[model samples]
Target: MEKRFISLIRFRVAKAQYLNMGLKFKKLLISFFSVFIILASFGLGNYFGKSQCKVCPPEEIDFSLFWEAYHNLQEKFVDKEKLDIQKMIYGAISGMVKSLEDPYTVFLKPEESKRFIEDVTGTFEGVGMEIGIRKGQLQVIAPLEGTPAQRVGLRAGDKILEINGTSTVDMIVEEAVNLIRGPKDTEVTLTILREGWEKPKEFKIVRDIVEVPSLKWEVKRPASGYPDIAYIKLYQFSEKASFDFSKAAIEIMESPCKKIILDLRNNPGGYLEVAQDISGWFLERGEIVVIEDFGGKKEQKIYKAQGPSQFLDYPIVILINAGSASGSEILAGALRDNRGILLIGEKSFGKGSVQELEKLKEGSSLKITVARWLTPKGELIADKGLEPDIEVEMTEEDYEAGRDPQLDKAIEVIKNL
Candidate 1:
């Protein structure tokens, strides 16, 4: 009986050991399948990710040439000490942007980016003048009123041949500007060629801290035969433009002035929002101020006047010149198109493209021309400027004599209106 009981116990222990081995094999199979499935999913995901990559080069464009050049420069180029990777990268980007041939679209290094910011904010130490590229040559866009540039006779449309004896041939606008701008009280010589000049003349100007003014108004009581005309000289559509204009408008409204002369002469434009805000005073609410055209790649953005409309019924004449540009051109176009207000003086400077400043890595930036500006009547203001109703030319003699034939004509026209 004792032997039979011991044999039964041994049989039960064998059955438990067999079940344990079977459970271990089942777990091993499950783990293997799980790993296999996971690896399969990962491989499939990688394949799809490459196909769907947004930044991948297009099939038609081979990027191998660029890599080939880079590798050759790295391996075969002599004078390795002169080869700087960062400078090479910057030069490559600059060349790429320049190839677009859009002068307004440029890549700015860290220091250049800071200088651009200072310029738009209204205060900077320089000979205060706006410069641009026209017909593949550097030209003066406008000289700020009451600044050193104007005092020294730097006129709009003047071709810049040299800066401080450095030839400006093939120099970009920013390069010319950098040569002209200097520390306060320092002098910079500019070689200028006007249309009627016999030869390029040099103008020596001293740099100063430029505080851009927005607008100044005065009531002109002429000869007692004519009605009092409110003359508003708008220097720029700056950050303080709207507020300054509002105060001027209030004062003009209180005064006995029945007509207005808006002098936009020598005004290089500022913010577009400021121009739109100022347009409200003259145009009725919902009247189109300006149109931004993205070449039909995107929906056109139309800016309308949101108005106080204080000067809607007021007879007004605008004064424009070759110096007037951008926001000034927009405002002039809006008023002339909407109200039939006459624009008096020379043609406006055609600088009406919309530039969007994109911040890049390491404090760099790219100012790209995103769109072209169109008038409410669909007049293109880029490259082709606005034509004035009365074509009046200001000669060099008139400027030197402190006589403004443009303002004289505007005052006369507004009186008759």
Candidate 2:
């Protein structure tokens, strides 16, 4: 079996839907063949259909005109050598899917599909920036920690103006991603427009093989006259997240700290299962962690905690910011709703939709948005992100001077608790 990366952010539509789609494709092929035979017998070569073709099915009355135009293009186009049938077929398919206008739903050509497969292997040569469409602009979700994008100070909320001198205006997220990612050690220039900036700034980042760690933890000593606290930052809910979080939890539990701070800032979320597993350590078994709401009266799926409840007695604070999304929001919402934990930071990045990738003909692929995820308390996590219990903004001065008011606020709140 092929190794597929199934993250919280990525899923596939049901197999039944795909099967039904195949049947439709077969029907369309038969319709085209039938039209070709009928036209040939009537000696209507390259003739246009002025009205409904009587021989075609009434249900496909509109499609007969499409076949007429297609045949006309094939016969009358002057650039005979330039007209590649395969490219035309692929372009038609791409155009058909692109009409949906959903950013998450994409048609990956053969080469693009191959690159996607390589990315899922957990090692890819790129600048390591997560990007998405925000307010109709191509926005940087977060620069992965320790990656070239982060090293060059690519901040979250930065709108991408151009990539490698090419304008990113109206560019799809996947198209931008393909442009940004390249062979390791190669440089890619990005022109970005951020808030409070006078104009767009260009940064040339060298790509590298990005390997994101799941979690990092340390016990911070008494700071600002506060007591010691265990600080754990979950980077992303990758496959190894549960094991890494459990190891960190054991270390934190053994330390002399009774208070915990879970930092999910700048965390572009991953697997939902991993989030649920990590939440188990803090929540009681059978507690609702998150809800999967399949729209249109479809039965909702509820994820419950399978817990040992090792940190049940500890005072917990979750630190989140604009980069916190998907699985991160799920965990924070679960903990806050179920365990009364406080989230201290700015609002999160609302990305609750699920995307499933299906392989298409000629090695191409299609990624379609399947469903939207909801929080435990039934809050929509799509466009409306989770609000912090204690909202604290990190100013530009804070970034330049290396100050963290959000983390400080979390510490203060936990100490007072």
Candidate 3:
């Protein structure tokens, strides 16, 4: 009996020893796997880190200060819930672009980018006027015809001192646009300072869906018994401008109009391609229209007229004013340089920089001024505007009296040609 009891105890002890050995083996396997996983993760992290570094340009900029500022904001900002990382990133990018001090070069967030598309598409909800920066002040480039702005007496060259009481001092064009535009039926107020105003005046304008016209034409018969003039008023170079201009060209060709009066007054330019396309009707094939100067950093681009040359020999006179800018300026420059067409009106607005819109992540965009526009004769149009062959000024009295002396002068000029 004693021997049987001792065998049982020995067997139990042996079982216990085998269980302990099994636990130790299991622990060893887990330890090995854990170490392997950590090593693999480290290897993958290093590989990815090096690959990312390879894609970036050589690091000449010290970004430690930027990171420090970012971290400080994240950690210590007053309202933690208001901390939007994406907005912070966008603000930083905007600041970087603003450092260039070029108002045309700007950063647009997703909403702002969408608004820009709306503008180029020739439709939007806003007070229908184009505003731009001139001499560091927000100036009215043009008030679209039949819109609230123009109907409310907003005129080209009027300085905008405030939008809804927000001072426009140091305000960028895009920022002012945002403040001025809103849902249809909303009202926006503008504090304007005209050239002759002793004090700034406020104009309250209601916003609406603005459908901008590209161009309008009429056959005008001068009382002086001159040839019928095809009076073409180009409003903007929006998306539909090329198509509209083409239609107008066809109509003018079919009509009995022999002289052309291209009225670009209050036209705040649009697409470069549209300008080039419009120039084709007036300039001979392969004639240089406008030159894109790249500040000697790259090869300059010369835009030549792709001619239908329909009006190449026709008597053409161009009208320009302070509101005529960018694409309008390009067209005016082309006509004067290529064909010696007479420009009659006030000097142009002189916004001659070329901006290229680059799409970034998250539907944002960066509009950077890639180059400055040069007339075909190599005259810079950036700061120094195009001088008219005959300078004509329209006074407030002329406007209030429903007298268009500029148009009358243009008619007179085209009559002799």
Candidate 2 runs further than 4 Å off: 1-61, 68-72, 75-82, 223-226
lDDT of 2 by residue, 1-417 (tens): 234644322335556677889999999999999998997966654343424454445553478776888899989999889789888877887787768876677888898888887777658889987898876788888888889999999888888999999998767777888999989989999999989999999999999999888889888776576667998989899999999888888888788888898999989898889999999999999999999887966898999999978988888999998888889999999999887799899899998888899987779999888888888889988878899989999999999999999988887788877
lDDT agreement with native, every candidate: 0.90, 0.86, 0.91
Q: Arrange candidates by TM-score, highest first: which order?
A: 1, 3, 2
Write candidate 1's Cα lDDT for 43-95 as tens digits: 99977987798566566888898889999999999999978999998888999
Q: Which residues of candidate 1, in runs, are more than 4 Å off?
A: 1-60, 74-79
Choose 2 or 3, whichever is better by lDDT. Answer: 3
Candidate 3 residue lDDT tens string, 1-417: 899999999999999989999999999999999999999999999778879783564458888988898899888999999998887888899989989989899999998898888777555789888899987899999998778998899999999999999999978898899999998999998999999889999999999888778989999999866689999999999888999999999999999999999999999888899999999999989999899999999999999999899888889999999999989999999999887899998999999898889988889999999999999999999978899999989998999999988889999988998
Q: Candidate 2, which ten residues in sequence have the lowest lDDT sum?
A: 1-10
For model 3, the run of ten residues with the poorest summed lDDT: 52-61
RMSD per candidate (Å) reads 8.5, 20.0, 10.2
Model 3 TM-score, all chains together: 0.82
> What does the lDDT come to for candidate 2?
0.86
* TM-score, cand. 1 vs. native: 0.85
Which pairs of residues have clashing backbones in candidate 2? 11-355, 11-356, 12-356
